[model samples]
Each structure stands twice: as structure tokens, then as C-alpha cells.
Target: MNRRNFIQLLGVGAGATILSSTLIGCGGEPHVELFGWSGPAATLKDIRLKVLSYAILAPNPHNKQPWIVKLVGPSSFALYVDPNRLLPATDPYYRQVHIGQGTFLEIASIAASALGYKANIHYFPEGQYGNKALANKPVALLELTEAPNVKPDPLFDHLLNRHSNKRSYDRTSLSPNEEQLLQTFHQKTSDAELVFKSSAQDQTQLTGFLTEAMAIETGNKARDEETIAMFRVNQAEVEKYRDGFGVAQAGMSGVKKIVAETFFLSREKLEKNPAGFGEQAVDITHAAAESTATFAWLTTKSNQRIDQIKIGRDYCRINLQTTAMGLAQHPMSQILQEYDDMLPLQKSFKEGYGIVPNDTVQMLFRLGRAKPTTHSPRRTLDSIISV
Candidate 1:
């Protein structure tokens, strides 16, 4: 059967609840296809490919998987931006994209070292694409060399365990010891400072701002439509794309899934009640923010490309540390994005957080204890590699 006919038949033949339960229980073929257990072990024999396999799994904004790779030689590869993956509505200036690339480079370097190689990375070899949309310019050039003396990064072990936990976090504050461990990154690094807001007053204020920001985003017809376009309502779309924002990744289950599939996931329903949907979005964001044990923001001295990349590296380390400490971290950065609608919120956020005019808030997130969450699906290395 043709693709359209198959989808139509599924929609018409099975009732919504029955289909949702079946898909959730059986855990359809798309899940299996998207979640390839092993990485590049059976197909590609090259060590470079093996390293790239782990790199492809790095956390990125919206799970866009925006990095493209080209093998330069036996020991080197060039990283490029996949222009099509750009989220213009959300990330107008591509700051998040650069940060995601930085995360990829950091992971690739760590993987290379773990595999008995030292990775040398040269950023923007073809000249920097500063504060603009990603073009055909190369982001970085990675050269890997065998190093018997180099030790694998301690953070390497947590790569698979680290994920953006979207579940509501426990409200209890962190112990002095846990706080000390998380603060060490700030103490040791000159590139960025980590600011933690755990007081009830601060959390309440931040939550209010976050919910307002989220409401603004949802109320924007263009932004909402863009986000809705990426939502994978069924097992078929989720498995096929293996990317974007999927309902499964949102931690929806059973009755919630059925309701979402029947109402919220339907474009027609959303169009009919965009205002209600926006209100629902606000409520969800408020609940998530209110449950935070702490709200952490990483601030840099400048908003340059190099600083943004450094923020990515620091953010990755922070994520790994969160995983190691048995905690959850979720990025809640809508207020910091660089779109026109976000300008006022950005100014207010900086003032509220005591961030100076010259300084930039590179990342903001809520962190605390939470139930274990599932990892998002990733594309295979073969699909991402250019040559």
C-alpha cells in the first residue's frame, strides 16, 4: 500500500484508544528501527566512524541532530551544519545550534580519547559564522591521533546515562555536599559562572517568568504552528522521523496518550482552540518550574562564538555531573532565545537575575531528583556522515 493509504487505513480502522494502547503495549517496529542498540559495530570498520557513532548521540536542541560530518583523511574529519535542521522561529540567530555543535565536538573528543586517540579540534576553519544563520561554513576540523598515555574522560562513562529529564522534579533543596559538587565546575572554570537559585522566593519568581515566557511562545501563531508541525502524534511518525518533539519523549502514558492523540495532537482541535492550548502550555510550564529544587543559569562574559562554544562544553560537563549525581536537569531557556518577541523577556530576565548588560546568559535549567526518563531516538551514523 502507498504511504498515505496506509496512514488513512490505520486512522479509520482502529479507534483512538485502542490504537494508542496497542502501540504503547506492542512498542511498534518504528521504536525498534529508531532505537538501534549498537553503534556502527557491524557495518563500518573504520575507527573514525566508531567515534562519530557516539558523537551523533550528543544532546542537542529539540533533538535536531544538526551536525554533519565529512571524513577528511585517516585521522581527521570536518564538521558542517545541516542547514535544513535550523529552527528559525525559535533560534533565529543560531546560538543554540552552535552550542549543540560544541556539545557534539566535546563528546567526539571524549570518545576519541577513550578509544586510545587524542582529538585536536580547530573551530571555524573557514572563518566564523558569528551571530547569523548557519551557512555552508565549516564549524570545526577534528584531527585524531593515537595516544597511549591519554586517559579517557571521567565524564565519558555518563554519556549514555545523561539525558534531559522533562519530568517534574522533587522540591527538596540539595544537600551541601551535592551543591558543592555541582559548583566545582564554576570554581574551576574561568569561562563561565554557574548561578543557582534555590530559595522559595527565587524559585517562585523564576517560575512566574518562565510560565509567562512559555505562554508568549505558545500564543505566537507562527511559533505554535512550527512546534505543532514537529509533533509526532503516532508511533508511525515517531519512528519514521526519529527526531523532532515526539509525544513519547514527553513522558505521556496510557490515558494521557489517548487524550493527546484524540484531542491535543489533532491539528484541527488545536486550531479550534489555540487559546486553550496556549493556556495548557502555560500550566505545564508552571508545574515544571514550581517543582524545581534549583534553577541554574550559566553566564559568560561575552556572547561571542568562542564563548558560546565554551558554554556548550561547560553545559555538557554540567549535564554529565547531574547524571553522575543521580539528578535530573531540564533546559528552560525560552526567555533567553533571540527572537523579537523574546527581547522584552530577555531584558527582564537579565535584570531579575542580576546579569550585567555586557554579560550573556548562555544556558538556564531546572535541576533536582526525578524518576528515570527515556532517551530520545537518534539517527544512525551512516545517515549523518557526508563521506
Candidate 2:
């Protein structure tokens, strides 16, 4: 089916509950064809879906599995963004959506590699006439090729094992080689930048900036609401939806509960008292910011949608790679994505990196070695794929 028909079907048939069911699978026909010669081995057709299960498990902002997959003749499958799952308010330009799409592509590509196929993906096709939203953008087409017998990227194994480590990181700094390896992920992307802050003083500075940035994000009425909506407050809801940001089961338990409750309470008050709610929002956002280590930004020369997705894919790749090196990544994107709250943080970033306004920053994340944390949940492969 064409993307337009698929989108229309979604609009008419998939309500919220159906959306949820679609993620985990209810009673429905298989959406993808099983065999093809161009993509992966025919034997893999039976198990490629299983391999994609691992990629679906990758973390995305708010557990939004903003991706759609179609097996095109056996050798190739196209991945597209799910417009219904976008965070239009905060991600006005759909930058987060694009990044999330990139993350999904990288996960599938890596998983394909592990399963003995080299997945070749090309971003938005240049010539296509169809639904404007789906047609113009890049489509990550995974074509199976003979896998190279190279040493496994320790990270390939960690794909399932890795999760964003949101808690405090150990004070020990990363070795030069580890840092270089992480940097190498993005060095090839002309429109990106990576800065590693390991010194105590720099770490302290980053922590302070993050604290302040978080405060501003959470304080703003619109931004806070956007974030809160994506948060799956309870473990039950988290498990059922199979997507969302949840407090790691291994981290400080009471902390996630307290934060979730506090936000819930604050959200209630915001409905009744706007002024008071605004002040509280700022306070909470700032407090949340102060809790991190190093800072890094993924910048581009232009702020187009495709570039953002590329930035996102590269970001996920680097983070997963870092996890392999026993390191962690913390996002401090409030400064880059939220204008009002993160102004101070932006100034600091530009000053620190000697960056100019002409250059666009697509992602801002921090890195360190931290204790392992809980992995974010994902929607099932059956939900994302179609024949």
C-alpha cells in the first residue's frame, strides 16, 4: 500500500487503545512478506523479525516508537516516521521525530549486522511522488549483504544490554581511547560536534548548567506538559505500553516516585493557579538540571528534518557505542531545544566550544561512566512492520 493509504487507514481505524494494541500485537494478519533474496538470507526471513525485536527495544524520547517499517521484496525494507507519534509542540520542526527515526534505523541496521547481514540504508529518496510527508524524507532501506567477518563491535552485543544511565556517574574519567572511539562515531558527519568534559571543574560546571537548564524546561507550562505527557509514571503503565521514560528499577526508587508525584501534583495546581504553577515549574526544572556530569552537542550547518534524523542516528550509535565502553549518556538538550529556559546554558555551550549562532545544535548530551540502569521499553516488531 502507498503511504497515503496507510496514513488514512491509521487515521480512520487506530484510536488510542488500538494504537496501544497495535504496538504489542492483537489479532491481525502479518504486515510483512516473509522471504526475499535481496535483503537477508531466506532463513533469516523467519528470524529477521526476531532480530528487529532487539532494535525495537532501543530507547526513544518518551518511548515514542515514531517509526514504520515495510519489507520491500526480501532484500529491502523501508522505514518511515509515524507522524501520529510526533511531539509537535516541543519538537515543532519534528527534529526529535527525525532523530528518533534515525535511532530506530541504526538499531535495525546494527541488529541486521549481528544476524549476518550488512544492512545498507539510504536516507530520503530524491525522486518520489506520494504522500508529501512520507515521500520527501529519507527512507532507511535495509538490504542484506554478506556480513564482514570483522571483530564484533562489543557494542553490537550491548544493543539489548544498554540503556540510558540517568543517575550519578562514577567520578572516574574515561580513558583516551574510549573517548576517541566515541568521538569517531560523529567525526565523519560534517554537521556535528562532540565535546567530552572529564575534568572535575568542567564536570561541576556542566552539572550546574544542566540543573539550570532542566529547571527552565520543567518550569515552562507548555514544555513541562509536553514532557510529562510522555512520561509513564508507573511501572505497570510502562510495561503495558512497552514504551516511555521510566525510573530505572536499579536506581534510587523513591526518587522517581517522588519526582513523578511532584509533577503530578504540580500539574494539578497549574490548572488551578497559573502564577504559582509557573514559579514551581521553574524551580523543578532547575533542580532537575543540576544532576549530571559532562556535556556534548550534535550540531549541523542547517536545521533541516533529514539532518536532524541523521544527527539522531549518529547520537544513538555513539551512545550505544559508549555503553559498550562502560560509559553512560545523559541528555541536556533543554538548552538547545527550549529557547527560553536554556538561554544561559546555550551561552555557556557557545562560549565553551567557540560556536557561533549560524551553526545549529541538534542534540546536547552528557557522557560518563555510570552504574548500569534500566532499559527503556519498546513497541513490538509486529506493530511497526507491514507487508
Index of the highest-TM-score prediction: 1
Can you give the lDDT of residue 103 in candidate 2? Answer: 80
Number of clashes in model 2?
18
Relative to the unseen true structure, what is the Cα RMSD of model 1? 7.3
TM-score of 2: 0.73
In angstroms, the error of model 2 at 303 is: 3.4
> How would you encode candidate 2's per-residue C-alpha lDDT over 24-46 as one tens digit per residue?
22111112111110122234445
lDDT of 1 by residue, 1-387 (tens): 332332222222221111212222111111212254355465666778878887886778888888889999788899887888877888888888888888888888877877788999998899886576456878889999989999988777777667787766668877767888889755675558888888989888999999989988887877776666665666566678877655444455455555556554665666676675666667767877887878888898878777777788788878877887888888987888888888898899888777897788888998888754546778777778886
Q: Scored by Cα lDDT, where does model 1 land?
A: 0.73
* TM-score for each predicted model, relative to the true structure: 0.86, 0.73
Best-fitting candidate, scored by lDDT: 1
lDDT of each: 0.73, 0.58
